[model samples]
Target: VFIGLGVPLYQGYGLTETSPVVSVNTVEHNIPSSIGRPLQGVEVKIGESDELLVKGDSVMMGYWQDDEATRRVINDDGWLHTGDKARIEDGFIFITGRLKDIIVMANGEKVAPVDMEHAILEETLFEQVLVVGEARPHLAALAVLNQKEWEKFAADNNFQDAEKHSEQVEQAILERISDALHEFPGYAQIYQLGIVDEPWTVENDLLTSTLKMRRNKIQDTYQDLIESLYKK
Candidate 1:
C-alpha cells in the first residue's frame, strides 16, 4: 500500500567524497524512506558511533590541499567515515541525520528535526519546512508554502492579499500541520510556526544545487523569525 502524490520517489545517499552515489533504490525494489542498499562493489558499515563508513573503489583518494582533513575522514584502514548517522535494516540504509544536527531539548530529549520535518510535510501544504528547537522546551518550524496553494487559500478565505501574513492564515496552517503530526512524539511536534514569503533557492543560498537545505545559512537568514518563535 504505497501511496504517492505523483510519481514515486526513491532516495539515494552519498557524498562528494564518494563520487556522489553510494546507494540507490531501483524501481523494482523501492523502499519509501530508506536510501537503499550499497551499490555493487561498495562496502558500507556503521561504526561504533553509528556513523556510516564506506570502503571501495568509488571513494575519493583524498581531499585536495588538506591532508589533515583527509586523514581525519579516511582512515589508514581505507574506510571513508561519512558524518551521517544511519542504520542498516534488512539490507536498507536509513539515514537519520548529521551527527551535529541532532537537537537536544531542554528536557534532555533528543529530537531529529529532519524526521519531524518529513512528517510535517506529508500532509501540510508547505513546499519546504525546517524544524528548530535545539535547546528549547518545544519545537518550532519555518515553513515555505506553495505559492499557488496559498493564493487559492486566500481567495477562498476572502483575504484581500495573499502575501499578507495574517492570523487566520497562520491558524489554518497550524491546524493542518498539527493533524499531520498527531502520531509523532510530543517532543517532536511543532509548537510554533514561522511562515516565509520567499521560497528557498540556491540563488538565495538557502539551498544547495542538489536541493539540500543549507541549515546554517537558513537559520542565519531567519534569525529574527526563529527568535520570535521562542518569545512569550
Candidate 2:
C-alpha cells in the first residue's frame, strides 16, 4: 500500500531502556523485512540464546534505584540484554522472536514458536495459533480455525462435523501444519494439535493490549485441552 501510494516507509527496532532509538533504516540503505543497521554509536550483538544485546552511549545507566533489576538486564560489561531473539545478516538485524517466549522441549531443543505460528497461519485455515511444548517430549499447538476457510475445507473433505473435533479433521489439520513447517527443523515440527472454536482477543484477556498473545493466560485457560494432547 505504501509503495502504491509512493510513500517510503521503513521498519526499525528499539527499546525504552536504550533511550527509545537503537536502529533504523535510512533512505540510502533501506532493507525490507529488517530493523536496519545499528546507530553510529550503538553497538548490537546476538548474545546467549540468540538474545539481542546492546551497548553504547545511548544505553541507560541503570533502573531508578533498583540495582538488582538493573543488574539483571545490564551486565557488568555494560551490555544490556534486549530480551529479543534476532539475527544479523549483512548488517541488517531481523528479529525472530522473544527470548522469554522460547519453548524448551524435554530433549533440550529450543523452539521459537513465533516463527512456527506465523508459518502455520499462512495456510489461511487457521486464524490464530499458539505452539506449546515446555518440558514435554514434543511440540503441540492450539489453534483457532478460520470459520470461512474451515467450512470450505470440511465440505471439500466430506467431513460431517465441521465445527467440532474428529480424528479425520485433526489429521487433516496436522497435515496442513506439517506442510507449513516443512522448512523448519524436524524437531520443530508439531506432533499434536488442539483446535479451538473461539478466537483469542484482548477483550477476553487471552491477548495483550497490543494484540500479542498472553501465552500464560491462554495456557491456563486451555490447560485441560493441552494436557489431553500430551496424554494421547
Best by TM-score: 2
- TM-score on alpha carbons, each prediction: 0.72, 0.95
Model 1 C-alpha lDDT per residue in residues 1-232, reported as the tens digit of each score = 3354577888898899999899998888889789999999999999955789999999999989999999999999999999898999988999888877888899988887887788877863679999888888998889998878777777887775644576677777788888888888777787788999899999998999999999889999999989987993
- Whole-model alpha-carbon lDDT for candidate 2: 0.93
Scored by lDDT, model 1 comes in at: 0.86
True-vs-predicted CA distance for residue 216, candidate 1, Å: 1.1
User: What's model 1's TM-score?
Assistant: 0.72
Q: Which parts of model 2 are misplaced by more than 4 Å?
A: none
RMSD of each: 4.5, 1.3
